[model samples]
Target chain A: AQSVSQHNHHVILSEAASLELGCNYSYGGTVNLFWYVQYPGQHLQLLLKYFSGDPLVKGIKGFEAEFIKSKFSFNLRKPSVQWSDTAEYFCAVNAPLRAGNNRKLIWGLGTSLAVNP
Target chain B: GEEVAQTPKHLVRGEGQKAKLYCAPIKGHSYVFWYQQVLKNEFKFLISFQNENVFDETGMPKERFSAKCLPNSPCSLEIQATKLEDSAVYFCASSQGTLGGQPQHFGDGTRLSIL
Candidate 1:
């Protein structure tokens, strides 16, 4: 079965520290990668996505992710973090559909980040 | 600015009661998906539909959970005889296509609390 894995369960850092969250998928075929963030009491929003072309894709709120095909990973990164960036992050992959079924996203266990000022 | 809309931001239900949730996919989107989040953990895909047809329901517990996406009507998820373990946030998402490589747009989830 296809699955997505996030290494970090919970992370804490002082403000202005750099951030990197590792994400890996088990599928070997062409896939679409996505990063989503959910702030407290807020809806889940798309942070970034990687479909094709450039491996490094930039997204809103100074977030970016690199798709490394050889490693089967698409890790999210931020150069510097702020208290406002504290949220739960989820990595998802869209694998190709089999016959008679629509494509669905395989999600990783979310990582909760707490940024201290 | 495409957005999927969900109704009933919060719901409180008693054991064995029925719970229903609704979702409206973004305009022009043909694919709808339902997911359940327990304790803010990984999202469990419950069901998906392409247009008015059921595409995938392997994750759904068919014993009590049922869902439908009718043409010209909002999609709905209904659970008969809810259990305490059913307390969770349910999210709806929609995409332009049902095939691979389409990023799904999510809606504000409906928080269901079963007592």
Candidate 2:
């Protein structure tokens, strides 16, 4: 079965510290990668996605993710962190839909980031 | 509209009672997906629809869970004989094109508590 993995379960960082969350998928074929963030008491919002060319994809709120095909990884990064950036982050992958298969987003166990001021 | 709308932001139900969740996909979106987020922080895909047709229901517990997406109406997920373990947040998402490559836009989830 295909799966997504986020090695970080919970992370705490001081304000202005750099942030990096690792994400890896098990599938080898073409895949679509996405990073979503859910702030406290807020709905999940898309941070970034990688569909095709250009392995480096930038997203809103100063977030970016690099899709390394060789490693089957799409890790999220931010140069600096703010208290407001504290949230739960999820990494998802949409693997190619095979015949008789439903193309669904396989998700990782979310990573909770707490940015302390 | 870009936002997918979900109704009944919160629900409380007794064991064995029925629970229903509704979702309205963004306009022009053809693929709709339902996911269950348990307390363990893992998302379980429940079902999916492409227009009025069921695209994928492999994750659904067929004996107790049922879903439908009818024309001109909001999609619905219904659970019969709800169990205590059914307490979780359910999210609905939609995408514009085919399921493989399209990015899914999610809605504010419906939190269900089974007592």
Candidate 3:
């Protein structure tokens, strides 16, 4: 079965500090990768996604993720994080369109980040 | 609508009572998905629909959980008999395309609390 793993359960960092959250998935076929962030009391929003193109994808709030096929990893990174950036991040993967009746996303447990102001 | 809209931000239900949730997918979006977010930030996909047709429902319990997306109306998720474990935040999302690569846009979830 396909599975997603987020290495960090929780992380703490100071404002302006660099941030990196690790995500790895186990899937033998082509997959669509996504990183989503949910702020406190807000809806889940897309941070970035990787399909068939460039490995390095940039997202909103200055967040970026790199897809490494050999590593089966798509790690999210930001040069500097603000207090507002504190939220839960989730990594998800799904087989590209061909897998009929199996298009549901396989999600990681998620990483909770706390940024001190 | 520009956004996927979920009605009733919160719902309180007694044990064995019925609970119903609503979701309105964004205009022009043919794919609708429902997910349940429980403790530990775990999200479980419940069901998905493609223009009122069930696309995938393998994740749904099917015993008491039922969903539908009817024409000219919001999609609905209904629980026949609520249990304590049924309490969770339910989210609805929609995408314009049928491909898995299409990004899904989400709505503010509905918080269901069962007593």
- Best model number under lDDT: 2
> Is candidate 1 or 2 superior in DockQ?
1
Which lDDT value does model 1 have at B105? 86
What is the TM-score ranking, best to worst?
Answer: 3, 2, 1
Q: Best DockQ goes to which candidate?
A: 1
Which portions of model 1 miss their true places by more than 4 Å?
Answer: A99-102
Ranked by TM-score, the better of candidates 1 and 2 is 2
- List the DockQ of the predictions in order: 0.61, 0.57, 0.58
TM-score of each: 0.94, 0.96, 0.96
lDDT of 1 by residue, A27-109 (tens): 88878899999998888899999989999999999999999999999999999999999999999988567733348888999
Real contacts recovered, all predictions? 0.65, 0.56, 0.52
**What is the DockQ score of candidate 1, to 2 decimals?**
0.61
Q: Candidate 2 regions off by >4 Å?
A: A99-102
Candidate 3 chain B lDDT trough over 10 residues, lowest sum: B96-105
Clashing pairs for predicted structure model 2, backbone only:
none
Q: Measured by TM-score, how close is model 2 to the native structure?
A: 0.96
What are the lDDT scores of the predictions, listed in order? 0.91, 0.92, 0.91
| TM-score of the second chain for every model | 0.96, 0.96, 0.97
